[model samples]
Each structure stands twice: as structure tokens, then as C-alpha cells.
Target: MQTKINKVELRNLEFDDYKELKNSMVESYPEMVGSYWREHHIEKLLSIFPEGQLVILVDGKVVGSALSLIVNENLVDKNHNYSDITGKYTFSTHNPKGDVLYGIDIFIHPNYRGLRLGRRLYDARKELCEQLNLKAIVFAGRIPNYGQHAATLTPKVYIEKVKRKELHDSVLSFQLSNDFHVIRVMKNYLEGDTDSKEFAVLLEWNNIYYDESPKLINLEKSVIRLGLVQWQMRQLNNLEALFEQCEFFVDVVSGYGSDFALFPELFAAPLMADYNHLSEADAIRELAKHSEPIRKRFQELAISYNINIITGSMPYLEKGTLYNVGFLCKRDGTSEMYSKIHVTPNEVQHWGMTGGSKIRTFDTDCGKIGIMICYDVEFPELSRLMADEGMNILFVPFLTDTQNAYTRVKHCAQARAIENECYVAIAGCVGNLPKVNNMDIQYAQSAVFTPSDFAFPSNGIKAEATTNTEMTLIVDVDLDLLKELHEHGSVRILKDRRKDLYEIKKINT
Candidate 1:
């Protein structure tokens, strides 16, 4: 057959060509490759050759191709051949060393064969094997006629020949002519009914090495240590007592060499008895009085200790409304505030507090930090959005008295930390708050957590203070550890999260 010749160049292939490649293969090999199983094999090929490296060109058009992947799998049986039905040409077994597999199947149009195109296509696939630095190239082809009709062959006979390399002569006839040799024949134990049609022989070419270009190593990285404090509540029947206690805790936290300290939800609150003792107006007044003192004390703490302190969640009276606010206190006594973007029904119904409308991440000298209050942590999107914004630390201030509150808190904190590759710090109210409906007020266990590790013991206790008690717990964190986990850890909780497999939506308001 005569054919036109055109320039051939190698380039990256698009994934959308899957259907086209399938159509081409099925159209040419209806007998050997059927339409029913073509989808399965094509899907496998798409996954393996996402960039379409296994391709062939004839007259500047794609005509033939092969699919392969480099994986670590043990040929444990010592009698297994992947080349036959599995189409797995390469594998590595840990015990006796391993090999990178190269698998490819080449198909030619019936009208274009007289030009020795089969060897040309095989040569093209060989180039791919060399490019991948594969150990061996293995495949199975039709068995030569054995004086019996192809339909007369039994599955047992096919399996037996596949295990014995009985067709080495015919296989080597074509392969050996191209510097290939029959190394062994192994049974397709995992092939199921697919291998019932014919037997196959495995082939290998030894001592063939390909040269690779040298790569320059770029190991430069930046590391920052971060800390989050959450769940700090300052509620006292007397505004005077609340400020006094907050001032004291600030002084004590300053005494420690903490880079950052976080306080929990509603860091400042006034006593509300059955919603009668304190009206809406009185609540705002108390919050205002506590705000300046609380802000000043945290400012002093941050400046004096040369650290950053997240003052946790406080009620910020904004225009005729109230917002749960978090602050980042800097060493210079300056502070940045982020209002809570999500509020629970309890806040809207019980506290008459509305949620904030936007997400805000702080740009710190160390790295970006995200701040959200109690109810916000319950919503995965808040933390996930912060993580997507490149925040390395999530500061959560929480207030809860639920049973196993701390355990639940710790679980969520650790999960967010691992999933976002960020640090989560929780500051919680441990002591009792004013009586609520006939139940005593609640608090969550407080702690600092990294991606896979917690700074506190496994008992889920990072640190705790008595409810309605006065205390400060300062813990140090290493941001570099988070970066390390992202770079080297196999359990990449954050990177491994499959958004395509799950629906992800954020509830901002």
C-alpha cells in the first residue's frame, strides 16, 4: 500500500480525545477489542495517560497508541503474567526488587499495512518505553493457528500456554526480529473470563537503558510558627468583675513567651437573666464598657509580650446591630477585627445576635491567619474557605457546655487542621456561665492542633480553665511543621480531598 508522508512532531494530548481514540480502536478491532469492554479499557487508559503520551501518528494523523502506568505491585505468585489480559506490562515487587511496567497496544488500519507499519508503530511504542525508563515491555498477541479452528480452543488450553510460553517461536518470530525475546509465560490468574479466548507469552528486553536529563534541585522553603486561641468568655454579673478578670488573664498571658493567644466565643458578655434583668440596650452598654478595657488589655499583652493575641469573640455593637467579633492584636498594640460570618440559631433566637456577611483573613508577618467565632467552626465551609485563601492558622473562639463538648470540639479542630493543612487553636470557656433555662452554662475543652498532631495529650485536653474561672494557657506552635506535612506526608488530608467526588458549598451568611 502507498501512503502520503507528512511531518511528525511530539506534543501533549488533550483528555477530550478519549471518545475519539475509543471510536478509532473499536472501529478497527471489532473482533479482538469489543465495544462492550472498550469503555472499561478506555477509562483505564484515560486515567493512565491523562496527558496522552502513548500516541501514534500516520500522515500527521493519530493512528495508533498504547497506555501504561508506573505502579508498585508484587507479582507474588511468581507464575503471574500481566501482559495477557490485564495489559499491565510493568510492575515492582518489594522482596526481589521491582520494575517499572510499560504496557501498550498498537492497532493499524486494514488498508495501510504493506509499508511494514506494524514494526514502525512498535518502534514508536518502544520510544515511549525508553522515555519512561521502563524495565520491560510486555504484551499478548493472537496465537498462531495450531491446526485447529480459533473457535475450537478451550480456555484451559489458553491458560496453559500462557503459563508455559509454548508459543515462543511465533511470539519471538516477530518480537525477536525487533530485538525482543520471550522471557516467560505466566497464567492470567486475575483475568477472569477475559483470558478465555487465547493464551499469551510475556517478553523482556534486558540491558537496555535510556538517558535522562539532569534535574536541578530547588529545596528552598519558608516556615512560620503560628498559634490560635479560641473559646474565651468574659461573663460576670458585674461588668467591673469581668474587666478585672480579663485584665488579670491578660497580665498572666503576657508573662508567658507565647507568640499568640486565642480566647473563645463571646469573649465579653453581661449577665442576662431570663432576658428581663438585661434589656437589649443594657447589653450593648455592657459590651461597650467591656470593649475598650478588653481591647486595651489585649493590646498591652501583645505589645508587652511581643506576641500576637487573638482576643477571641466579643460582641461588637455595629450600627443598631450586634456582631460577634474577633481581633488580632499585634505587638505594637494595634488590632485588626474580623466579624463572625456565620451565626447559629441560638445566637439569632436567644442572644438576638446577627451574623456577619463576609469572610476575612488576616495578613500576618508570619503568614495569613483566619478568624471565626463559635458557631462558625461548626460549618466546615468557614474553615475550608479560610484554608483556600492560604490561611495557615484558624483562630476559633468557642463557648459550649454540651456533654463531651471538648471531645467534639477537639475532633472538629483536628479535622479542620488536617483537612486544610492549617493550625487550629481553640480557646474555650471552662467555668460556668449564668444559668440558662434551668441548665448551667457550658464550655468546650480548649487546645491547639496541627494537621495530624495535637499539641495536647490524646485525652483531648489542650488546656482547660474552670467555668466562670480565671486562667490563661499559652502554647507554642511551629508553622513549618504544617509545610513539612504538605510536602512529604503520604496521608495528605488536604491535597487528597476530592472536591470532584463531593459537592462543596459555603454558607457565608
Candidate 2:
């Protein structure tokens, strides 16, 4: 009576499924007397090796499970029994630093037996083995039909017959079909078992595709040389002068061998200076009209310099609504746009700007990176989400009119670096825009920050410009050092996160 396994979902075992898992195991193997796995054993296995446990659901009902643990090759001797490898079913021998995956148990409920659910479980184990880069999978396979042949054949002879397709023992045939070869046989592997006559066949599945070579640390891809610009504001007579100012900075930074150059938030505000005669709202609207041309010029500059450029931000008008947008232009001429997700009260009240709804990370030659405009970087959850997506660098472009505002941005940027274990580079406007009404009297100092640990700078500041100055600060950040900090630093904040207790997940509409 095989049930049709429509809508089967394979997922990691959750602690909430402990009761169902135990019930399924007891119901599926009722023939073995006194061979019940208690809840404490499952809890211990999950506490130590949760990644090795998997469960299968058919139409929203738990139907099967596969349990495994990692161990060193030395622990699995050629003649060892199941108890020696599994620590008497308590799985106390599970090792986090092991190189081989040892199968503990796999079972499918009786109602779902012949629908090939076991094959799906086995395939999952193989995938997990490859993903963890384990050298092999070793398990003691039960020979359910071996008792009938035990009087006439030895375990080795029985396995040989099974391999040659002359014998059809269910468990051995399935393992052989899945590329497992019998290493040897073990006696007294499990107690009170009519199956296998209290003997088990040792099977090994070698990962032929596993690479044993040492991984070379790529410094070229791991190190990003950054150029941070504290842009100065001035009265603009025309767009040509604005282009010249941007070109000057791009040329100078590219000449200094910067892999990526960052410009301050609202660096192009001076372009709005020419529209002072109009109302403040009208002036911002006029500024939005130049977003396209400005983006094109930035792209050209990025291509000419052969460096990635983060164009602080520009006022963009789309579908009669304005948004503050930043353009990340790469040397290859491809660009991504990040709209300001957190709009300031001033922007909403005065300019009728709306906040962006989406957040994303960009894949670049250097590494995964994220862009957060001034107010967006102040939020911890946004940066944490980016960090979860493997972002190594965060670029922030800001505009502040007072020292207090500048300090807030700087402190928050540094905090994001420390909490997320990532590099944060902040660039801002430093000079005044007397002609512009709402954007006058700028104060800023640009800085690059790293995680606060031994792997990074002691002060957490990689390079900082003089306060209230128009300057470019250049620094080289090691991305490899970030990897080390995340894994083995003073505190592994990323790895130590309690995902079961609380998680920061994105909701999709």
C-alpha cells in the first residue's frame, strides 16, 4: 500500500518534529524488540549535529527521516561495530571538525515504503556530504534477508553475490545501487535483531570528486583599495563645471590605484545652485532632471578610470514622484541603482520624496557589497540583513549640515562595521552651498571603518579625512581578514547568532 508522495518537502530536522520523528521510527521498525530511540538521544544529536539530520514531509505529514554524524576517519576502523562509531546511539562521538560523514539511521514510514522515498533521503545525504566537503560516507547497512542465507553463505560471500546482482538482499541491493561498496562485515552490531542475524555489513561511499588540495588565499580578490571623497560644495554656473570637479577627483583617485572610489552623498547638489531663483521645492525638482545626464557622465568616468564608482546620490524624478538614488557604476559599464530606503523628514516634507521599498546587495569583482544612503545606514537590521547575504563591504554616502549630524552618521557607520564584521566606508559633503536654501552649511569628515578586533585596526578607523575639509582618503582593506574574524576572532557574532530564538527574515509579498 504505497502512498503517492505528491507535494513532498525535504528539509532540515527541526526540534519541534522530535515527537513525530520518534513515532515514525518506532512504527517503521517495530520488528526490532527493545530497539527504540528515546527523545533525549535525538535532542543530543540535534544539539551537536543538527545539520546532519534531515526529514521528509509528504503532503504536510512527516513521513521519513535520515540521521547522520561527522567523525574522523581514524574513529571508523575497518573492524569497528556500530556502537564504536555512534557512541552507543547517543552520538557523543560527533565531531565538528571531522572529514567524514557517518550514517546513523534512515527510515521511512510503512505507508510510504515503495514510493522511492528512501532514495530521496540517500540522495540528500550525498549532497550534504559534498557540500561539507567530507571525504566519504561510512555506515553499517542492515541485511534484512541475511538470516535466511546465514546457514549457507558467509557475509563476504553474500555481499559479493549482492554486488554481482545474483543475490537481492533489500538493504544491500539499495546501497550497492547507490555506489556504496561493502568494506567488511561487523558482528554484534545491533542487539535483539532478527535481521542480519545480529551482523551488519560495513559500507563506504567515497567522494571521488572531493578536492584535497589546500585552498590558496586570493589577496587580489580579497583586498579592496578604496578612495573616499569628502566632496566640497560651491556655486555652480553650469553643468560643465560640475563635470570637471567630478573628473578631477576621479582622475586623481584612479591615478592613486584605487580599486573603488566613493563620492559623498548629494555631491551633485551644487548643480541645483543655478536654480536658486526658483522655490526650494522647484529647485530640487529641477535638480532631479539632471539625474540621467549625471549618471551617464559617472559611467563614462568609471569606464575611463577602470575602477568601480559609487556616485553618492542624486535627486531622481520617476513617474512624477522624486526619489534619492545612488548609482554604482562599474568599469565594465554595468550599473546598479539603490534608492534611499529611509527618507528624511525634510525630504518628505519639502521635496515630496518617497522611501524605497527594496534592499539588495550587488555582486562585483571585488566581492559582495551593499549601498545604504545616509539615514538607511543608521538602522541595524538593514545592515544585518546585508551581512547575512554575505556582504563584505558597505558604502554609505551622506550629507550633514552640522557637526552633531556628522558625528551621528560616523558613529553609526562604525557600529555597523563592528556588529556585522564588515568594512564600512562613509563619504560626505564638507563644504557650504550658500545659494541652495535647505542644503547649506555642510560639515563632514570621511572615514573607512573595519571590525573592532585584532584582525582589523585598533581604532577601527582605516583612514579618516580632516574634519570639514575637502579631501580624498585612500585605504586598503583585507577581505580575507573579515573571513577570519567571522570564524575565529575574539567573538564570532555572525556564527554565534541564535537563529532558533530569533531570526531576521524578509517577508515577500
Candidate 3:
């Protein structure tokens, strides 16, 4: 019944024992910083920070400590900060926003754990930033190599086991859990890793005012990769395994260099799966609940990967009717939603889904891309509209029925790619999905295709997943080729179209 006691005070690491701080981390993790990298980190910090700037504190004499610095020095050269010319302007000093605080080290001692000491450290940093009038705070963490969680569930069982013992969670989780928003996941930062594979999180304390429509600067030009967090429909019964598999598919696709990503229609279907047996009106109401989380997660993924993501269709509730819609999200948090304009007759009459009114295009770091949902893609005119606007890539997220039917759809996709002279990506649900009629139907052959050239032309099929299989099909599309074909050619696919002749023939028949 006596009062609990604890001693906590903030102090600078300069006047304190550095070995004690270093030992705290090393003891918990022998190689918290590997032998070769430990010296490099210490040297780097010393070179940049002044003696008193590296703040550390003794929480009851060795409970926790942190190392931080204010990055007020001019960046080495705007261009050197990025891999491309555009970045020179994007990260330039022209930004009125001021300096940033960067945390170099944060570790809690084993003896005094579970006292929310880490949060206190973060609070101290936040207060320091506010007091100093800093514009932002940023830090780097380990790349969550959460491979094991995804291992037993994916096709890479053997490869996954080899990395089972690697530690990857501590730093990244601390940053994210403490309200730090991740800005980018860097490469080759961690020793022994060939690529820049570190997670960079930022906590912006000032209002950022920038115009010219900010785009992902593509700071690191490695093949663009995508990340798809599983789309879960909250109401479905026993879909945990399916969603887990779906997430594994996303990981595989990301690993394959597909810079942009999209999920199948109604990724929130699982959340609304329980309503599969409900009345159409009731189901629509239940489905609306899934939009916010889906948008937020997709936004996070886009920001994390520095890529574009098309959120597969979800039911957007507005003015009382559900609109089957897809959202095109960019790296900086701006997105445009495309509604399914050409809803199937069944969808309109039976399910009461409304058709969208317009066609839209998304301009990305990669290039301009368009979307046409399931039945919407069947309308040649719908795709033609995007072509007329000079879209280079077309994405189709469908929930189709049979493999044979899907083959026809695939052929349509190929024809669309050839005719529009653009890349066509078709993503579909592979396994059984709960239907409105109380039956589950398995979808077929989800694939990505491009116009073929003389060597493989018919733009070769990039990748495809089998009917009734749960997997992601990813490919690096060369948009430049699509641009070339559209510019000059023996065959001008869109330009050569015989629309008038087709109408004449139809009338004659």
C-alpha cells in the first residue's frame, strides 16, 4: 500500500557514460549494431552532431537512453539527395519549412522495462522539437523482415526458413507505434544487406505548404515495388486463411518488382461477407463501414513504397445508393476515385448498384494509368475513352465467373492493349467468393498483358495466375514502349479503328 518510486531525468549523453548506453543495447542484442557497422554509426553521428546535442537520460540510473540531433545544416546538394533530376527541385531549400530533428539512437535497459519509458523518451523529443521550433522529426529503423509470418503461408516455404532467425521488428514498430509516420523504406542502409532496406519514419511538427501538385520523387530508382495489405471484409466467416493467403500473394508481387499495385473488387468483401446472405439494401449499409480503413491502409502502403496503388472497387455510399468504385492513391496522400460507369444489368437491376458518370485518368511517377472495373472493361467504348485521352496503362480489377469466360475477357484485354497501344493489367479474385445468391463461385485466370512486339509482340503476357488459385501476378511494364507504338507505327491501333465502318455494317445487317 506504499507509494511506488521511480527516478527519471533527462540528461545529455556527452557528460554520461557512453559505454553504459552502448552496453544496454548490445546485451539485449549482441549484434544490435553489427561489428563492422557499429563504428561507422558512432563515427557518423560524431561527425555531424555537436557534443551537447546528443541527448540521453538515466531513468533511475541506466533504465533507458536516447541519442538525437537537429539537422539544420543545408542538405549536401538537392540533387545528391535523390536519384533523379526532378528530386533536385522537390527537396530543394525553396521549401519554406525549416529544420528537422533526427533520432540516432533509442534503447531501453532490460532492468527497468514496462514503465512506458519509451513513450516518455518520445514525449521528451516532441517537446524539444516544439521548444526549438523545429519543422519536423525523422528517424530510420530496421526493415520489418516479417518474412516468417508470411512464410508457411506462401509458396516460398524453403527460402522463408533460412531467414526465420533474423530479427526485424524492434525499431520499426517503436517508430510506428509511437505515432511516427513512415516517409520511406530505404535500401542498403543495414550492413550485409545489398539493397537500401531501412525504414524511415517522420514526425512532421510544422505545417508544410508546397504547391505544383507533389509527386513521389522516386528518390531511389530501384525497380518500383508495391505493397498490398490484405483487403479484409469484416463480416465474412472463416476468411482468416483466405486473407492471409491474399496478403502472401501481395508480398510475392512486391518482391517481383511490380512498382504499382491493386486488389480485386470489393477487397472489403470479407468484412461484409456476413452480409452475403442479407438483403441488398442491408448489405450496402454494412459495406460502407469498410471504406475508411481501406483508404487509410492503401494510403500508408503507397507512402511506404513510394508507389501508386489502385484500391480495387468498394461500395461508396452517397445519396443513398452504393457505387462500385476504385480509388487511385498516390504517394503524397491525394487520390481520385473512379466509379464503375458501365454496371452490369444484373448489378443495376437486381443489386441496385449505380453506374458512374465519367471516365478518369491518374497521372503517376510511372506514367498515366486508367481503370475499368469488371463489367466496365467489357464495354469497348469505355476503354476507348481512356485511349482517346492518351492513357498508357489500363488496370482492370474484376470478379469474374468461369475460366473460359475469363479467357474471352483476357482476349479482350489483349485486344484492348493492342488497340489502345497500352499495357493492360487484369487482377481478379482467384478462389471462391461468397455470392448474393448464397452460392460461392470460383473465379478464373487473373493476368497482366502488354502489346506484343515482333519478337514476342501481342505485347507479351507478363504473368498470370491459374483459375481457382490465390496469387498475385506482377510485371514491370515498359511504358516507354507503349508511348513509342502510340507515336509511330506500321499500325496505328487506335488511329486505325474502323468505328464508322462498324456502325455502317451494323445498320446494313
Per-residue lDDT tens digits for candidate 2, residues 348-393, read 8888898887888998879899999998988889999999999999
Error of 3 at 72 (Å): 44
Model 2 TM-score, all chains together: 0.61
State each candidate's clash count.
Answer: 24, 0, 20
lDDT of 1 by residue, 148-242 (tens): 43366453454345345554333235665555555444444323324223344455553244323323653212343333333343346665566
Q: What would the TM-score be for candidate 1 when compared with the true structure?
A: 0.50
Q: Model 3, 445: alpha-carbon shift in Å? A: 1.2
TM-score of each: 0.50, 0.61, 0.50
Q: Clashes in model 2: which pairs?
A: none
Candidate 1 local distance difference test against the native: 0.57
Candidate 2 regions with alpha-carbon error over 4 angstroms: 1-220
Q: Is candidate 2 or candidate 3 better by TM-score?
A: 2
RMSD each, Å: 18.5, 17.7, 22.3
Which stretches of candidate 1 lie above 4 Å from their native place?
1-241, 270-276, 280-289, 404-407, 433-440, 453-470, 499-509
How much is the lDDT of residue 240 in candidate 3? 52
Sorting all predicted structures by lDDT, with the top scorer first, yields 2, 3, 1
Give one digit per residue, the lDDT tens place, for model 3 in 370-442.
8988777777777777777768778888776676767767788888877677778877765444554422464
- Candidate with top lDDT is 2
What is each predicted model's overall lDDT from 0 to 1?
A: 0.57, 0.87, 0.58
